[model samples]
Target chain A: MTRKAFITESDVRALAADLIAAGTRVVAPGRVGTPLGERIEYRVANKVDEILLGQDEPARSLKDFFLPPTDVILAWQEKKDQVELTPVSSTFAPQVIIGAKPCDAAALEIVDKVMDWDYHDELWFGRRAATTIITLACEGGDRSCFCTAVGLEPSGTRGSDVLLTPAAGGYSAEILTDKGEKLVAAHAVRFGADKGADEARAFAEKGRKRVDANLGLKPAEVRKWLAGHFDDAFWKSIALACHGCGACASVCPTCHCFDIVDECEGLGCGVRRRNWDTCQTAKFTMHGSGHNPRADQSSRMRQRVMHKFCIYPERFGEILCTGCGRCARVCPGGMDILEVVSKVNEMACGGAK
Target chain B: MAETKILAFVCNWCSYGGADNAGGMRLKYPADVRLVRVMCSGRIDPVFIIKAFERGADGVIVSGCHPGDCHYTAGNYHARRRFAVFRELMIFMGIDPRRVTFSWVSASEGGKWRDVVSETVERVRALGPFEGYRGLTGRQHG
Candidate 1:
């Protein structure tokens, strides 16, 4: 069993302050100013007070920390006769993330399966090893939140080193890994007896009940229906409103496609970078010979769903989605992924709709 | 410093013939421009232009027959409509749309081809090399 202890709100702040004072980078959820309005986002925290741990969902997830929007993988310099290649460093400095959402934290582990599948990504695993994730038990965002439906709970501890549950007086922190134990052991004075154990259980129970009402489906059954319905007309109708903007993939934690480009800095000197790419774009599937396998938005949209609910699970033994529902929440076309998933569940249970 | 590099995609029926006519007339233009002959302007996809920039072309030009003079009847018309949307997408992707130029050139317009090459080379030379795209490589992470 994992070790449990209580950390008062003030002690948590002191611990963060200590980390910052020691020159360690700390990232947490905080308000960010955008052109539209203020939204909560995970940003580098300069002070302890900037840390916001609550039920509010950040506009973005934690994937960017590990897999950046763009990064240089290598650089090339052409000589008179030969070319020299310089590989980018894969090592990263140690850091800590506080108050991460359970859905966002679990996403890293889910994506880890592929990063280590055929070719192990040194950069991704380098950052993963250099950082310790402290996840805050969620209240599960609005009805769009469906972690429970995807075999995760509001207080799930899949990818977290330490799981913190909100309770009366303070938070009950469960040390699940050696990293978490090291953190608590160094700041032993900041931890105490687990006084909020009962209240933490109640808080988790209430959160589960609230999220359970969002969507109910069997993952295996949904995958079966999706695998069999590759050419169904339902895909065409479901994608009628979609414009293939790819905003869903931008916000989705598990959509990990990337495009590599070699851009020249000057004559004969250039860098090869891998930038974030999505399957929703026409160019993503466009062949050099002017042939496009996915010629329409319908096929593209179906590919997104199929990859998440069917293909990944069939290969990885788990679903690709944490059911964060950011895809449904940010879609400009008003397309709902969960609604499509619920339809799949219905068809798998009874008959095709 | 090296001279600016500009890539031009020209139609086999019109713009390519215009370039050949310029060569036959012995007209002097900037040697920085490189020509790529295509069956029609409509055959050029936006990805080709993007790929050109990725491969170190500082600027790009697409020249074909006038709208009504297309050999396939509507190849230039399709190219016009596609480029209108593609320019906007380039802007959204943080690329300066000014780096791309679209023009009409008839097979007999050799003087016009020389003027187009001169102007495009001058404009792109002022804009300098596309260092903005190169800078994007290591920008997103710490």
Candidate 2:
């Protein structure tokens, strides 16, 4: 059975302070001053006061912590006629991520399927093994959030070691893993006896109801339509507004394609790095002979939706997206992924079909 | 000052010939530019420009035939439309669009090619190397 505890607001703060004092890396959602304005962002907490839990959504997801936007895979140097290679280490320092959104947390687990599928991604799995995630049951996210529609609840605990739900004067912490149990045991003084289960349940239900009103779609039906409709007219006109800027992929927690490039600093020595890449661009499918398979923005846009809903599910047994809606919110051309997927669902499962 | 590297994508029948003429005339132009000949300006995708930046080019130049003088009819016209949109994307991604120069140079205009080269090299030198894109490569975080 999962252990339950009532962690008061003061205790939460104290725990963060203790973790920081002990030289542990603690990440939390905090107010970040950006050129755009003060936005919530996940960052390594320097002070306990900087840790903000359960309010506005962070501008970016927790995926960046595990799988960074850019990483050096290896470095090569010229030695006479033969080239020498130096491989980067995959081991990482232990860290704890607090206040992860359920959708963002679940995305890691869903992507875990592919990361370990064909070849074991040592870099990806290295960070995963070293970190623990504590998810805050979401109470805020605008109309863009639709976690419930994608089989994830606002208080879902899929990839989280501990799930904290808001309650009266505290949070109801459900310790779901050995990591979570050990954390609570180490800080036993900071927790009280379980007393807010009812309040947490009520809070979770309210969050679910609010998110459900934003959008709804049958994912399986949408996947079926995407699998069969390779030449659907809906795709040809779907991305007229898309600039193929790939801003959506930058923000998407699950869009994990990367481009490997060798950057030579001098004549014979350089680093081979992998930077975040997206399919929305023409070059993603371009051949060396200059033939592009997905020549236009519309076809590229189709690939994004099809891969998320159909290809990933057929291969991994679960949908790639967690309905985080960052793709919709970040798209410069106002391309709403939820709306596009809903249209597919309507075409496949609505009364017309 | 460190020498800036400028990658130029030139059309085979027009800008390539123009570059050859400039070399033949010994017109004084910056040696910063490394010319890559393509079949047509239309063949240059924005990804090529992006990849150029990723590969350590301080700046890039795309020189094709004069609007109506493309060896393949309407090649430069297609290139023009693509560059216009690509410029906006470059700006959005925090890259200065000025780092990329788009110009027309027919085979007959050897002096014009020299001028384009000198002007682009001077402009890119002022902006300096693209460290912002370089920062995106290599290990950023753990």
RMSD (CA, Å), each prediction: 6.1, 7.3
Candidate 2 lDDT over residue span B43-141, tens digit each: 999899988887778899999998888888998899999999999887987779889999998888899999998888898999988877855643544
DockQ of each: 0.16, 0.19
List residue ranges in candidate 1 displaced over 4 A: B1-141
* Chain A superposition TM-score per model: 0.97, 0.96
Cα lDDT over the full model 1 = 0.89
Native A-B contacts reproduced, model 1: 0.20
Question: Per-residue alpha-carbon lDDT of model 2 for A1-353, expressed as tens digits?
Answer: 68889898888889889999999899999998879789888899999999997578888888788778878888899999999999888898878888889888899999999999989999999999888888899874678888888888888889998888989898999999898888889889998899899999998989889999988878888888888899988998889999998988888888889999887764688888888999999999899999999999889998999889999999998888888888888888888988888788889888554
Give the per-residue lDDT digits (tens) of candidate 1, residues A90-196: 88878889999999999999999999999999989999988889889997678888899999888899999999998887799999999888988888999998778
Show where candidate 2 strays beyond 4 Å.
B1-141
Give each model's whole-structure lDDT.
0.89, 0.88
Q: Which candidate gets the maximum TM-score versus the true structure?
A: 1
Clashing pairs in 1: none
